[model samples]
Structures are given as structure tokens and as C-alpha cells.
Target chain A: MIDKVIIAEDQEFANLSVQKTMDDLKVKQYDYAFYCDDALAKIQLAQKKGEPYDLLITDLSFEDDGTAQKINDGIELIRAVRSIQPGILILILSGQYRPVDIHNLFENHEVDAYVRKARHDVQELKAAMDALSKGQRYYPRSLAQLIKRSNTYEFTEFDITIIRLLSEGYQQNKIPDYLKEHNIKPSSLSSIEKRLNQIREELGFANNQQLMVFCSNAGLL
Target chain B: MIDKVIIAEDQEFANLSVQKTMDDLKVKQYDYAFYCDDALAKIQLAQKKGEPYDLLITDLSFEDDGTAQKINDGIELIRAVRSIQPGILILILSGQYRPVDIHNLFENHEVDAYVRKARHDVQELKAAMDALSKGQRYYPRSLAQLIKRSNTYEFTEFDITIIRLLSEGYQQNKIPDYLKEHNIKPSSLSSIEKRLNQIREELGFANNQQLMVFCSNAGLL
Candidate 1:
């Protein structure tokens, strides 16, 4: 379990909000650093002091005094930590939310989760902690749905209908009456039922209930 | 205080996802409905049965009956409930993130909170429940900051600086050195110090630490 956490962000408001959230969660002990450099120092110091942090929370943009194009900001922070301590969890909480920024955070840097500071709920940090404690990757539910929907193929109208109906607990016998009442004719009733079953089979649902839960979790329901 | 919740979403997945979340929270006794009509009926029935719901969770869109118009969406659902149960806590969880949609939810309908289905963390839902239980408004911290920065002009750069330095336990004398290091020549050092004092005065902060905590909680830090 990740017993200790370190928050690094030069922005005063963001840093304080995170700290208060941790406090509200009644976290027993933790350390916070205001700058990226000091954050690194603290991480290394913890290692030296024999009480290393299990998680790192950082923002992407910080006060960069140097002109050298730093490869690391938040992304590099994770990379550096991974180089030294590969198993340590990294979560990025930043105001940046451009698609490119999200892609870079997820694809190149391999961050455990990337939370946009602009859309964050305190539960996000707690969820990250919960995920770590439970030995699971803690991606935001919304982000997961986004990634799944964006990368996966868009659902066809018919596919949506079948899934929607099945999710509503419509038995094969009841669907035709509902479809007829709704005035849409996809095919023969058996074919419609077969297609529904086919879709369920493809999605690996054991029953209509499982399919509903699947779509619901995927944010498609 | 809200031991029971009512969900009014057309999608079975959404309804079940909410049910699962409620179950995860150990809120064992809750009810849901498939359509707005059914949901409204359930609420009325619960009221008549002397077990009125404390919260209403609804989705903005419904796939039922091939309805595409945005007229009777989540906002409409909120308005419907308000007419009968004006004091009921309402939460909108939707995939949409349009500024117009959010504005209508908060400004026009006065929803307790707007959670984007795409960005919401389940842990955030828990945190929100915690706050709601205490009768305090709970918004995702990131969203609060974004709204504060984008919608209001009350927070100035100097105010942010003061918040940052104070949060880090930097004394008044040391704050000027911190500003100078940042290369932000906001008139003279005394002027900068005066700005901090003025902010302190305006916010009714007794000390720099108080200002820092206030800003943090307000999403201004």
C-alpha cells in the first residue's frame, strides 16, 4: 500500500487545495514541496532517510527559472522517479487538457493516471490512493470511457438500440412489441433477436444484465 | 443525512452504474427508474409511502424511444423534480461538457452540482456525498479552480503570489525576495507588500496563514 505521498506544484492555490484534501481524508503523515527541484530533493531525501513515498502527485507547469527547454516538467518528473524507483506510482494533476497533452501523458510518459486540474474532484486523489491500496491502476472513470470510446469504433445505431434494449431488461419476447410500438423496423423479429444475441455474444455478456452493467461502466448506457 | 437516493436515467447502464456506486458506498436501500415518467412516479410513490428520497441522480440524455431532442434532457428532469420537491438535492451526471449545458445546469436550474460523466471520478462522488451529508456545497476541485479563473476577475496575480508564499510558511519579509526572484516587478516591494495586506484586509483574513487556507479552500490558491 502507498502509505506516504508527496505533492509538488509551484502554483500556490493548487498545492494548498491538494494538501487540504489530504488533510480532510485524515491522512496521518505526508510531505509537500512547492517547486519541482525541491520535490525531487524531497523524494531523494526520503529514500536516504529510509521512508520513501509510495506515490507522487505533480503539476505539469511550474516556475521554470532556466531557459533550457526542460524535457521533464510533470512528464519528466514521472520518468525520473520511475528511473530511480520503478514501482512508485505517478499521478499528474494539471490544468492542461488538450488532446495532445492527454495523449502524451498517457502514451509516452506511461503515467498511472492523468487528472486535469481544471476538472478535478478531490475524490480523484482519493481514488488514486484507493486504486494503489487495492493494487489497481486508478484512471478516472470519465477518462477511461473517453479512451475506450475514442480509440474503439463508434457504436452503430442498430448496435446502440440492441444494447440499449437489452440493458433495459427487455427479454427477447418483449423487445419486438416495444420495437413495433416505437415504429422502427430493423428486421424480422427473430433476426432482431439473433442480432441482439450476436451483439451480446461479441461483447462477452453472459446475460442482458451483464451487458447493461458493461455499457453502464463504459459510459455508453 | 441522505440515506436514500433516486436515479432517473433512461439508460439501464447508467441506472445500474449509479446503483453499483451506491451499493459500493453501502447505501443499501435506494431505488431507480428507467424513464423520467417512471422516475417521477417512483419519487411520488416514495413520498406517499413516507420514504422520500434525499438525492436525485439523473442523466441528461435518454436513448429510449429514439428521442433526439434536447428539450426533455437532464435539465428538464431537474426542473421537474424541483416543482414537486424543491429542496431535494439534485446531481447531474452526463457525458456532455459544453459550457452552455453546464451554465444552464448551474445558472438556470440551480443544480447542486454538475458532474461530467466523462471526467468524474467515482471517489469524487463519494467526496461529494460526504460534503452533501454535511450540507456543504461540493464541486470537483479542478472544476472550481477552472470556473474561478475563467469566470471571475477577483483573484489577481499578486493575490496568487501572496497565497503561494503564505501557504509555504514564507514570512512577509521573505515574500518580496520570492517575488524578486520571479522577476515580476509589481511597482516597489512595499507596494507588493501593501497589496498582500490589502488582500488580507478585503478577505477578512486575520493572518497570512488564514489567507492561504482561505484561498486553498476557495480554489483560488
Candidate 2:
């Protein structure tokens, strides 16, 4: 049960909307901050008071006021809050719709959930809160699809090394010689060819060039 | 020489920051609105007075204040404003970093420029304004890179049709039958094979499956 919550949003109406959602959820112990610095200060103060917040809902983009804030954005705030309270749940509530940026939030920032502020966002926020109550992370469907699509092929170190070599203009036959020189295990012509073929089959690439392109575009190499 | 500008931002500090930028550029006849509806009304009023805005700078996300609004988001506001004054220059000023979304703004909404809110955003905003003055659209380097990467292949209608059929699990040999039935040109097996090979070479695909995957990922099909 989330007894304590803090929302860091700059917009008055957005903060009010979030408050309305919390009210609907019957969550009473919630605080709001309009800036990242204020949000960080509240979290730190709460920690010092021995009454830490259970969840932190924040927006990624904050309007810069030229006040020279220490924590400028939500990402920085999350990092600061995490350092102060390592176990606090973080839910990103913003209008950001970038798959790569959202993916980074989960992979790097350890955000508990991402709720896009859009049509039906209020309902989605309710659903996300429910999921978080059960200790499960929630991601919007589009972001989830992106994550799943990228995770379709789990590229091992061996696969990445081979792909990197191929991307560097190394021929399949010459890869074995280079691998052997580098003391890489299973550095045979057949192994290299088989691995290459396996990767192509797995990724549904028709040729080495296509595989390289996919790797490059997907940011694997 | 740019003269008039209207900044539609929700935050007071952000609005002030934009005002500072405009002041720096010596643009005197500028207006400000806190809500999209208000911005639209201002534009409509300006049109009624026979003096439409020279430029419209808006943020994509607007905090919904629970009051029913005719123009809810910047995109909707842009559309509304465009219908009123089609020749008005639009520059999106926000912290939105999504490439796909930004590309859509340029391609679909006809936004003249997008200046992300960052450390050097004030300077970039100046540059964007200068470009607009010279009749050149300005996109941040990151967004420009995305446009370039996506434009790597200008897929023809025929190519898209072929790739679509292939994505639908149509075999290479069987595509001719489907194509002939649909009255698609170059339905011969040899033609189809050569075309597929040509597409693979163009897109650096190693095989048909890779092409399908790439097409699916790229949203071509």
C-alpha cells in the first residue's frame, strides 16, 4: 500500500490532474513540488525526518526559469532521489513519447513505471498505480512493444564481436584468422560461418550487409 | 527581418525565457498565451484585426486543467492556427526529443523548425529564427540525422507493394500469382526475383526474411 507519495510537476493544472488521480485512488498522504530542486529537497528532508516517501511521480521536462537549479530535469532528480532513498518507487508521468528515451528510463534509471500524458492517460495512470501497488512495473503498450521488439534477439558477446568485425569490413574467411590472432576460442572457419548464418536466420537477415545495417540501426554495434 | 512573434507556453518562467530571447532578437511585437485555447483565440483575433502573427512558437505538451478546451495540444493548436492563417511560420519550442514524433511534426504538420529546450536552446532558437527569415527550415542535428537515416531509402510504390506481400508470408515464387491477381505490374517470377534482389541490394538485406523484418520495423509495410 502506497501511503506516502510525492509528485514533481511544474504545471499547475498538470499537478492538479495528478492530485485528482491520487484522490480517486484514495491516496491521502501525497505532496507536490513544482521544481526538481524542490522535489529533491523534500525527499531529502523526508529522509531526515524518518518518514520517506513510498513513491515519486515526476515529469521528465521541467521549464527552466534561469534560477540555476542543481537538479535541472527529472532524470537528475531521480538519480538524486535514488541516492537518498534507494528503495523508493519512481513513476514517470510525462508527455514524452520517445521509445529510446523511455527504454533508457527503465534500463538505466530504474523507473518503476512510465505513464504518457495523453488521451485516456487518467485511466492509464490509475492502472499503473494499481500495478505498482502489486509491486509490478508498468510500461505503456507502445513502449512495451519497442522493448519486446528490441529484445527479440539477445546478442551475446560473441555475436556482437562477430558483428562488429563484419561491420568493420572484415570478411567471413578472414574473421577466423583475426579471431585466432586475438586468442578467441572456437576460432575456426566453420564456426564463424555457422555463427554468421545463425545470426542471419535469427534476425531474418538475407545477407551480411543487411545484418550489419540492422545491427547499426538497432545500436547493437 | 522577423518582427512579430507569439509564444504559447504554460510556465511563467519558460514564457519569460522566450520573452528574453525575443527581446535579444529585437522582436518587439510579440504576444504570449498560457493556454492553447487562448493562443488560438489570440490568433483568431489577430486575423480578425487583419494582422496575423508572423510566427507561432508553441510547446507540444499542455497541462490539461480539467476545463474542456477546444485546442488541447500544440499540434491541435497548430492545425487550428494553420486553417486560419496557412502562411504563418510555426516553430516548436519544447524539450521533446523523440525523433519519430519530431519527424512527423515536420512531414505532416508542416512545422518550420523545432528547437529543443536545452542549455544552448536560446542560441539555437536564434539560429532557427534566422533560418526561417532566410526561408530555410531548421531541424536540430539529432532530428536531422533521424530524417536522413529514415530517408536512406526512398521506397517506391512498387517496392512497398512487393515488401508488403512478402511481409504477409507470400513466398518468392508465389508472389507472382498474387501480384498478377491484384493486377500489379512486373508479375513475372524472374521480374519479381530480380526486383527482390535489387531491393535487398539497395537496403543491404541478405535475404527475403531480413527485408520483411526491416520493412516491418521501419513501418514501410
Candidate 3:
């Protein structure tokens, strides 16, 4: 059960809105902080009291208040909180919508859920909280699509070698010769052609050019 | 010369920070609005008084204050202001970092410059203003990369048709037959092969599959 929650939002209205949503969900023990320093301090205090926070919700950007803060943004706060209480559920609440940055949050920080502060954010926040309570990770649909598209293809070493050769201006007919020179297996021209065709079909690419573009854009090559 | 300017930002502190930067620039007749509706009203009034704003700096997302607003977001405000005064220079000031969205602002919205609200935004905002004064457009380095990557290739109708056929599972050797059936010029097998190789070289793709992937991602086919 998610009984203890802490929200770190710089805006009073946003904080109240989130608190109201938590109240509607019947979450009894919840606290709010307007600064990253205060949020980190609360987490440390709760840990010392032998009752660490169950969930930590924070915004990625916080307005500068002229005072030096140890933790600057939500990502830093997540790192700090995770170090002190590694088991606490972390949910990011922000207006950021960059696909690369959002992908990094899940891949690097291990955030449990991401709720964008948009038009229907209250409802989305509720949904994110519910999913987290059930121990399921939640990603907004658009973000989920980005993750899915980038991760759809799993390239093997042979696939990478083929793509690398292609990107370096090697013709299909010449790739086998290079592979043979490198003592790589399946270096025959027919095998190289077949393997390239198979990869193209798997990726739904109509031609070799399209597959090259996909691999480059997806950072596979 | 930027004689008159207007800023639309919801946060008081952020507005003050922007205002302070403008003050440093010695901009004499600058105004501020906390709501998009009010900003639009100010623009209309300025247009009627024969003293239209020379530039507009606005944030994309505005927190709702319980009352319904017709001009709710910065994009809507931009459209409204453009309709009233088409020549006013528009510069977006926001925390949004989505490459696609930023690209759209340049391609569709006719924005003159975009300054992300980050740590060094004050300096960037000044640089943007300077560029605008000289009748030049300004795009942050990261946003510039997105624009460059997306615009690397310009596909002709013939090129697109070739890629489309390739994507439809037609082998390179068989594409000439389909092209001849369709009455496309240069339908010989060798000619088709040469055209494909040229395109792959132009786009820096090592193979036809990679070219296909690029075209697909670039929305060519």
C-alpha cells in the first residue's frame, strides 16, 4: 500500500493540485516540498526515523531562488534519494517532452513512472500513481512509442559489422571480400546477400538504403 | 531596431528574470503579460494604436488559473498575434526541448527565433534579440542539429518512386521490369542500379537497405 508520499514541486498551485489528487485517492500521509534540498532532507529524515517515504514525485526543472542547493534538478534528486533509500518508488513530474531525454530517464535513472504536466495531467498523475502502487512501471503513450520504436530491433555482432561496412561506402558485392579478409564466418557473397535480405525483411525496410537510415537514426551503427 | 517588445510568461520570477535581461539590453518600451489572453489583448491594442510590437517572447505552456481561457497556450497566442500583426517578430521562450516540436515551430509557425529556458537562457535570449535586430533568425545549437539532420536530403519525384518500389519488396534486379511496365524512363537494369548507387552515395548510406531506412524515416517513402 502507498501510504507515505512526498511531492517536490516549485509551484504552489501545482503542488495543491497534486495533493488534491492524492487526497481523492485516499492517501493519508503525504508531504510537499518546493525545493530539491528540502525534498532530499525530508527523505533522509524519514529514513532516519525508520519510516522512509514509499514514493517520491518531483519536477525536472526548479526555478532558481538565489540560494545554493546541493541537488539542482529532479534527475539529481532521484540519484540522491536512490542512494539513501534505494527501494523508494521514483516518479518524475515535469513539462519536458524530449524523447531522447525521456528515454534516458528510464534507461539511465531507472525511474518507475513519468507523468507529463499537461492539460489532463491530474488524471495522468492518478493513473501513474495507481500503476506504481501495483508495482508496474508506467510511461505516457507518446514516450512509450519512442521507446518501442528505438528498441524494436536487436542487432547482433554480424548485423553491426554489415551495417558498419555499408555506412563506410562498401558495396554489397564487396562486403564478402572484406569479411573474408577479416576471417569472419559466413563471409561468402551468397551468405552476405541472404543475411542482408533477412535483416531488411525483419526491420520492414523495403531496401538496403532504408535499413541504413533506420540503423543510423536508431544509433545501432 | 527592437523598439517595442512584449513578454508572455506565467511565472512571476521567470518574467522578472526576462525583464531584467531586457533592462540590461536597454530596450525602452517593453511590456509583460501573465496570461496568453492578456498578451493577445495587448497585441491587438498595440496594433490599433499604430504602435505594434516589434517582437514577442512567450512560453509554450501556461498553468491554468481556474478560469477558462480562449487563447490558452503560446502557439495559439502566436497564431492570434500573427493574424493581427503579421510582421511582428516571434521568439518562443519555453522549457520544451522536443526536436520535432521545435522543428515544427520553425517550419510551420514562422517563428523568428527559439530560446530554451535553461541555465544560460539569459545570455541566449540576449543573443537571439541581437540576431533579430539584424533581421536574422536564431536557433540554439541543439535545435540547429535537428533541422540539419532532417533536411540533409531533398528527394525528387523519380527518387521517391524508386524508393517506394524498393520498399514494396521489389528486388533491385526486378525493379527495372516494374519501371518499364510503368513506362518510367531509364528502365534498364543497369540504369536503375546506377541511380540507386548514386542516391546511396549522396545520402552517405553504405547499402540500399540503409537508404530505404533513411527515406522512410525522412518521410520520403
Candidate 4:
């Protein structure tokens, strides 16, 4: 399980540098490519040759000018490999910042680890390799923090509109009339109360006042 | 195990809002406070009363007045609880932007989950609770992306210095003298070769040429 590896980076120098680094460490078996397509092909070859690619190291952005369209981006490559071999542990190396894209990748693509380009000269890189060798996902401390910090609460647009109106000093009894005037859905008093109650229960609030306070403090209002 | 809970928030409105949310949900069994100290007291009291606190909801920052020292911030509370009770689950409610700090909290503080305080309504709050109740750590998808985008090859400070010299057009054999001139620790020629070989092996490079090319493309050259 720890014998083979493959890297799909566009930069020849990076690929060669990593190869030399691995050689210095006495690691004998590995593969490399300068584009996503070649990397994907190699992975398929490895699988067909009865030696599946164990680790896939890829750069998120590619400058492959050979193709007219951006057909072999790193994100697309990750999706491709995942579609065929869902068990393959994929790691991404990006030079730029794209939080939303990466988030979508983790939620939809099932990446096993992430490392930053800055760690090429730091001990963090060694830590990533160590973690990967153990069959455990390794995220550089920076990346872990990025992935773990978020304020995503699953509220619909309708809920937000109602909360906004309530925070503006509109009474609950009058909200339905305002909502109806604004062409909002579920513009009924009972339904509005139900939604408010649902929100209160979800946030562990005791009453409408408490819910309103929470919305205000969270900047939702 | 399912009864006691703790809230460590600095904002009075946020604190009260969460408490009210809990109350509305019919969760009258938990403890509440506006500061970390009071939260800690509640935890300690619960322990003394033979009922350990179960869930901890906290924020990372406090509103300091510049008079007295900030006592027992949310992160500190987490550390304290881990010291007193290592198995207790911790959830962080924060609005801080530094990914490194969030990473440290996860790596060192062992916070189980994180939620952001950004334009959120009650529905989002409820989703967080649902995830918490399921014994799964809830992180915003955006945060997850930040952590999972890097696949770096490790290098040491010495390697960095060497690469700097190498990038400046210094020949392989001339690197040692440059290092010595720069007050770097002297390494034998054989060791230098060995180190380069180690780098090669670790990164799975095919040869020295490959290493150089890879480094150049990755901007490490």
C-alpha cells in the first residue's frame, strides 16, 4: 500500500525537484506527469497494469495552452479519478486562493488531503508525507483551519427575508401583510409563526424576542 | 451525559440569544453565562455536583475594554476543559478570519466543531445543532476548502538556503563554499549529494534533470 505514488503537476521543475527529494530519502518507486491528461492516463495504466496509483498529487490550476479549451484542470482531474476509483486518495496543491472551489471539491469530490505550495521549504511538507504514508489524510495546519472555520447555517431565502423584516421593528402580526405586499411565499400569520417557532427551536431560543436578539447579534438582521 | 451544557460568549446579546434559543427548544437543563469565567464556574460546579458539563458552545473573541486583562477567553476555556476533562466535546462559534489561529485551535485546542457568526438566521443555527447532536463535527464548507488544497513536498531551512543559492546560478559543487561564506553550518560534499538524493527520492523524481525542471516550474528555483 505504501510502495507507489504519482504526481500530476504542470511544472517540470517541481516534478523533478520532488523526484530528487524522494531519491535523497531512498524512496525508489514513483511516477510523474506534466499535465492532468497524462496523469489520468498513467493512473489508468497503473490500474490496468495491476498496480493502481496509490497517491495522486495535483496542482489545482493548469496553464496548458496546447488545448484551446481548459479541458484538463486539476479540479476536473480530481473528479475524473473519483468517478472511476472512488477509493484513490487525492491531494491538491494550489498556488492561489479559492476557498469556495475547494469547499465544493471536499463536499463533492472526496479529497483525502491538502498541502500548500509554501510548505515546499518547510517541515510541513514532511508532515504531509508522513501522514499520507500512514493512510491518514494530512492537511497543513493552515489548510485545516481554513476547512474548519465557517458560518454556514442552512436557512432558506424566505426565512432570511422574514427575519430581516422582524428585526426592522415590524410586529409578527403585521409581517404577513408586509410579506403578502412584497409577493413573498407563505404569507400567512400561522405559517409565519410556525417558521419563527422552528427557527427558535433550532437555535435553542425560548421566545420570539430571543430569536430576534440572536439574529441581530449574528448580523442576520 | 445529555443534560449539562456550557456557553462561553462575550457579547451579551449573542449569549442571551443562544440561551433563548435553547430555551425555546425546551432545553432548560443547560447552564449559561456571558463570560468564559462564568462558563468555567458552571462547568466546575457541575463537576463538583457530580454532573459533568456535556456540550460547550463558545466564541473565540471577547470585547476587551483595555482596562483589565481578558480572563479565560473561549480558546482558553477550551484548553482548560480539555485539561480537566479530555473527552468533552467542544464547539467554537467565532467570526475571526485568520486561518492559522483556527488551525491552531483545531490542532492544539482539539475543538470538535466551528461555526461562523456571519449574516446567519435561525435556520442556520438549527442546522448547526442538528450536526452537533449527530456526534459529527460541523465545519463550514468554505473552511474545509481552505485546508484541502495543498499537496506540497517538504524542504528544510538548509534546503531553502541551498535552493536560494542554486537559484542564483550557483553550481552544485560551489554551494558548500557559498553556505560557509554565508555563516551556514558546513556540510560535507558527500552529505550534500546524499541530501539532494534524499530530496529526489522523497518527491519521486526520476533524475536530477527532472528535479531541476520540477523546482523551476513550481517557482522553487
Candidate 5:
């Protein structure tokens, strides 16, 4: 398992929650900083001491309380850390996750993973760690899908219904039952999976969740 | 001291967290619902059984996953519960909280308390419950202050310094030391308290936290 992480977040409660997750994951070598500058300083000092951090977890925005900071935001801090320690991994734990921002982070900035600060964020963070450990970039959807804006995609009524069901919290496997009950054509589980897979491939979305969000954004569901 | 309560939130983790708090607070008769419709049904059933709920803690947004719901949103659900069980206290636990929305909720919606979903929200929830027990509203600040929008308020450099400290994670008691170290005038603890108190009273914010946010919003800090 990976060790030696630095969490740079402003909210003490959120930071405490992250620490709890780190504890649960058996990571004991993590340190925390409330300011981006402080986080950068720690990373620099660690590098100088020849004991560099394996990962950097940060929040996108930090409240400015008139305390002057060399690095004011997460983006700059990420850049600073990247220039000094090019091999280090960086993960973002933030509440702000717009599709455009996700695209920018992966395509432009070298953010390794993004775990949105939500109710099950601990689990998400754990999953991200697992992926990052395997040299995989962890984000909500594939990078190709994230960059694919709400393109004018034609949706059949069946597509709309299935996407809406997924958005409503129905698991894909369970969706066959709902479709069968409604007497929708190709209601078999295999057929449903095939159709979903086709849609996902066509839209470049990785999963049903992404498909649901995109269709909903396009006012198709 | 609330005997029986119902929580209507979709996110299982947040629901679980609330249940944990209820347990910590020794609230034994609480129930959970994943949808606003289910919550209403539970409340209605309880009312029919002559075991009406004492409190309703709910979120403003519920995921619209294909399930048909009479109560589409939290506001409508709150109104529905208020009509059937007029005596029940209602508390909103939502992540989406803006100053204008807070004003509308207190002034027009008759919500008993509002606990924004954040880190340390459990403590905030406990504080809200204490206030609700005494028949006082629990919100970030008073209703009058919420309705008062950002007017042209002049701020001295000294006033900015203290609020800045508070925003930067420094407690009010710690401000005197920073002030004294910097050779700022009125560096005593009493003086610091008095100044913060004056600003809080003038702006009608209840605590330093709220004052810091307001001043920061107004670009004073």
C-alpha cells in the first residue's frame, strides 16, 4: 500500500474526516495543512530532507483570511508541487466538480484523481487510492467523455426511459425487471446490458451514471 | 430531547451520519427514509397510529429517480408535513444554503432550524436541537440580519485584521497575542472581544464565524 501523503484542505471537519479515512485505510504517515502555502512548504521541506511525500491531496478553493500566501489556490499549489516533485501523485478532494473543470484538470493540469466531497467521499477516496496505486487516473468518468460536451445526440424513447431509471437510482441489473414489467421490448437483462453498453460506447461515457447526467443535462431525461 | 424524529435524505452516508448523531444524543425513536414521498408516508402512518413524529429533519433536494412522488421537493414536503402535523418541528439539513435562501426559509417557510451540511455538522445539529428544545430558531444568524443584504459598510483596517484572523482559523482569544506581537493598539483580550462584539452587533451577526463570512463577502476581509 502507498504511504506518506499530505492533505491540504481548509475545513477542519473535512480534514478530520479524511484523516479518519486514512486511519481506516491503515495509512499512518499522512500529514495535514490548512493553507496551500503551508502545504507547499511541507512538501519542499520533505523533499529537501530526502523523505518526499508519495501523494498530495488538496481542495480547489481555500478561503483567504488576509494571511498572505505564496501559493493562493489549489491549482498553483499543484503546479508548484509538480515542478519540484515531478514523480509524485496528486489527488483532489473538493466539493466543486463541474464537467468542464474535470476536463481541464486531467487534460491540462496533472491531477491524478478527483474525489468529490460528498456523503460517501471516504469510500470514493479509497477507490481513488486503489486506482492511483495501479497507475490509473481516478475521476468520475473517462477523460474522453468528460471532454465530450452535451453533443446533440438523438435519443430513442427507450434510451430516455433507461437513462431516467438509472438517474432515479436503479441499478442496471435491476433495470431489466422494471423494463420487463412495463412490457418494454428487449427487456431481458442481457439485452438491457447490451443496449446500455452500446449507448455508453457511442457517447464515450464510461458508465450509466455518466450517461444519466449527460442526458439529464441535455434535457433528454 | 426530541423523542421521535424522521429523517428524509437520499444519501445513505449522510443519513447514516445523522443516525449516528441521533444515537450519540440518545434519540431512540428516530426513523429514516430515502425519498421525500416515503418520509411523508411514514409521517402520515405515524400520525394515523397516534404516534406522530416530534421532528422532521430533511434535505432540500432529493434525487428524482423515476419513482413518482406527490411531494416533489423539500419545500413542498415541509408544507405537507406542516399541514397534517402542525405541531411537529421541522429542521432542514441541506448542503445548498445561500444567504437569500436562508432568509426566505425563516421569514416565509416556517422552518424551525437549518443546519448546513458540512464538517462539524453533527455538533451544529446538536446545537440546533438545543435551541429548538427551548423554542428558539437555530440558523447561522438572526432572521433580521439575513434579510439585511450587503449595504455600503465601511471597515477600518483594525476591524479587518480581527475578522481576517478569525477566517484564518485563529480564535478570538488568540487574536490578542497576534495583535500584541504586531504592536497593534488595543491588544488586550477585553479590547479584542469588545471590538468583535461591536462589529457583530452593528452587523447583527450572532458570532465571529458569521461576522467573518459577512465581512469577507463584503470584501472587508
Candidate 6:
């Protein structure tokens, strides 16, 4: 049933891999677009011609070669694609976003599958495509376990604000001044310090610097 | 005539690309290795069997996943292979290193061709292979111009010493004292300052911070 598809990716190397996989599966037709705008235009043209693409595979990042883009990123492009073609399946093939990022995509957007570009990308991509073609969502097992591990740290907006400030080189004592200027609650220096200490202790980090790095690595800020 | 090639690369996607290309070229036999040591072992085995690989295509960087490696990187692997089998052709296919890095490969190692992993990589790779098969070297025209531009600012070992110190967060004035302690020439504060000024002005950078970034970007530090 998944005969025709369009690959919305910028990298030529990734496109070749997809082309090889599509050939192996004997898919009748598959096309590629290097730019998000070009992909959108192609999809729209296909819809007008009454030959809609069965699935849309895309990467998260597209390099801006000084070209103006209406749809900037992968998530935005997904939303745009859904608005036009609600029936089309969406599969994200990327190495950019973290496991938590993928989970967010599942919750917010109706993403069908996520195949990470990694050491075993070729086989994983094949398995993902096969699962999607069978009307099943393909969430990678390793990613599912990683999501569970990363989801343990539940950061409220307030916690994120503190960690973000720490990562930006605002010392613990200076955070109160920044918070107070913006009328953020718990603007007192003592409260800020206590909250930071609690979060650091919960994460078992030695200090703010380590906590900052951990937050960054987890795509928190 | 191009047959029995070995692809030394970690990523499966790349292996798939090479496999497709080799299949198109009608190569008799092809093999792959995910690590430098493994690639060397394969080459050695083939040599023992008296049917050695015709060419070796390798990437510059390899990830170390806890296992101890005899040969760490691609250049080392190339050297080890050449020491055993000097008749084999060498092609450097990589996306990590800059054009200058490729020039170094030409100067030091007998690298036959360099194909960058970029957009239009499939065509570029095919062309490189076709040329290599005809006993001609393939250095991309784009890389040739880039090498010419990048080679303009030649950093002596001493100049690299100063820039490396700057990249390590040392102040400009503090460099002379470190150099003095190390018994380096031109250890006077004024001499260090003058030399840095000269280099920065030649590069048209406003300050040492910008100079540090430029040196880091140019692979000088």
C-alpha cells in the first residue's frame, strides 16, 4: 500500500540510503527534496494531481544556505504537512533531537515513527518503514528505554528557569536580581539558592557547573 | 578493473552507499570493517590468501566504544596497511576533516583520491572511482581552491604554541611567562605581544578573542 513516498531530507548521503531501501522494497516511486519549501511545493502539486504521497520521511535540521524559508524546522514542517494532508503518515529520520524530543513529537504531533541515524541506521530504517507500511507505529525499543530514563527528572518551568540561568553564567547570588527584575516568584536569594541546591542534590551533581552541563546534554536548554 | 575493494567506515548508511556504488560499477568483491583494527586484520587476511584488496577507502575519525584499539584513527590505519601492502590504492572518503587535512594526507600518505561526504556525494564518489580506476588521482576542484585559501596562513610550531595557549584560556600577557618557563625563544612580553599583533592584523581580526576563534576554526590550534 505504501508504494509512493517523498523523502524530505537535505543530506545527499541520507537520500542515497533511502533510495536504496526504497529500491529493495520495490516501492514504485519515491522522490526527494533538499529544502523544506521545495518539499511542501512538491506535496501540494501531488495533491492537486490526485496522487498523494503515502508517507513523508524527513530529518529535523535543514541547513540554511541564505535562502528564506517559511517553514523553518522539521516540527514546523510536520505541522504544516498535517494541515494539508491529514491522512499521510509521518516518520522522522534524524540524529539531531534527543529521545525526550522524540517523545514530545509523539505527544504533540502525530508522528508515526522515529528512526535515528546511527551505526545501524540502514536496518533500523528498513524495519521502521516496514512497520509504518503495515499501519503500525514504530517506536524504537532502545529509544523507549532511554525516554523512560530521561523522563525521571521532571523539571517545572521554574526549575528550567533556574538551570537556564546557571547555564548562562549567572551566578547563584545574581539569579535573584534577574528573577526579581522580571517579577518571577521566589525572587529572594535564599529561595533561589535553596531550590538550586535541591535540584543539584536530586541530580547528585557536585555544583551548578555540573548541573548546567547535565541539563545541556539532556536538551533541557 | 576496480575490484575487491575494502570500505573502512563505522556508519552503516555509508556502507550501504558504497555497496550500491560498487554494485553499479560491477565490482567483483567488496568488504567492510567498522573499526581500523578490524580493517587492518581483513587486509592482512586477504594478503595471506594471495588475493589482496585492490583499494582501501577509509574515514578519518572512528569512535572508540570501550574496546582497546591497536590502530586508533584512519591515518594510522592507512600507514599500517601501506607498511604491509604497499601496492594498494588509497582513497580518503570523509566529512570530518577540512581541505587542509586532505592536503596533509597527500603530502605525507600516498592518498589517491579524496571524496567529501556532502550533497551530490554519490556523483562525486562515482567520478572519483572512475578516475581512480584509470590510474588518475581525484582531488575535487572545490577542495583544491579551499586548500589554496586555507594554506595562506602558515602557522609555525611556535606560532601554534602561542595560539594553543590562547585557546586554553590564557591571557595574552601571560603567554611570555609560560614561554619563559618553557625556555622558548622570543619570551619577552613585548616580543610576544608584537608577534600576536602581527598575526592578528594579517588575519584582519579585531581582537585576541576573534583571533583565537579563527585559529581554532582554521585547525591551527
On TM-score, the leading prediction is 6
Model 6: residue A51 alpha-carbon error in angstroms: 5.4
Of the two candidates 1 and 6, the one with more favorable DockQ, higher being better, is 6
| Candidate 5 local lDDT, A1-221, one digit each (tens) | 47899999875556766776788888859999989989999999999999999999998777665678787788888889999999889998876434444555766758888877654567788999989888888876633463465443556778767766755546667888899899898787788778778987887765443454444434343
Prediction 4 global C-alpha lDDT: 0.64
Model 4 docking tier (incorrect/acceptable/medium/high): incorrect
Ranking by TM-score: 6, 5, 3, 2, 4, 1
lDDT of 4 at B91: 77
Q: Write the per-residue lDDT of candidate 2 for residues B7-111, one digit (tens) a residue.
A: 898754456567777887899699998889999889889989998889999988787756788877887898889999999999998755444445567668579
DockQ winner: 6
Worst 10 residues of 6 chain B by lDDT: B209-218
> How much native contact recovery, as a fraction, does model 3 achieve?
0.23
Give the fraction of reference interface contacts each candidate recovers: 0.00, 0.00, 0.23, 0.00, 0.05, 0.32
CA shift of A147, model 1, Å? 21
**lDDT per residue (tens digit) for residues B89-169 in model 3:** 999987744444455677685799998765457778899999999999988877688667865555666777777876666
lDDT of 6 by residue, A1-221 (tens): 79889998876777788878889989999998888888888988999899999999998766654678887678778889999999999989885446556667866757998887766788888898889888899988777787777666767788888766755446677888899899998888888888878986777665453454445556677
CAPRI tier for the interface of model 1: incorrect
Q: Can you list each candidate's DockQ?
A: 0.02, 0.09, 0.18, 0.01, 0.04, 0.20
Model 6 stretches with alpha carbons more than 4 Å out: A1-4, A10-13, A23-29, A34-38, A49-54, A60-116, A126-221, B176-191, B219-221
Give candidate 5 regions above 4 Å deviation: A11-16, A33-38, A41-49, A63-72, A118-122, A142-147, A150-221, B11-16, B63-72, B118-122, B142-147, B150-221
Q: Chain B of candidate 5 versus the native chain B: what TM-score?
A: 0.64
For model 2, the DockQ equals 0.09
Candidate 3, residue A135: the lDDT equals 85
Question: Residue by residue across B62-95, what tens digits does model 5's lDDT show?
Answer: 7664668777688889889888998899999876
* Deviation in Å, model 1, residue B117 alpha carbon: 1.9
TM-score of 4: 0.35
* DockQ of model 3 vs. true complex: 0.18
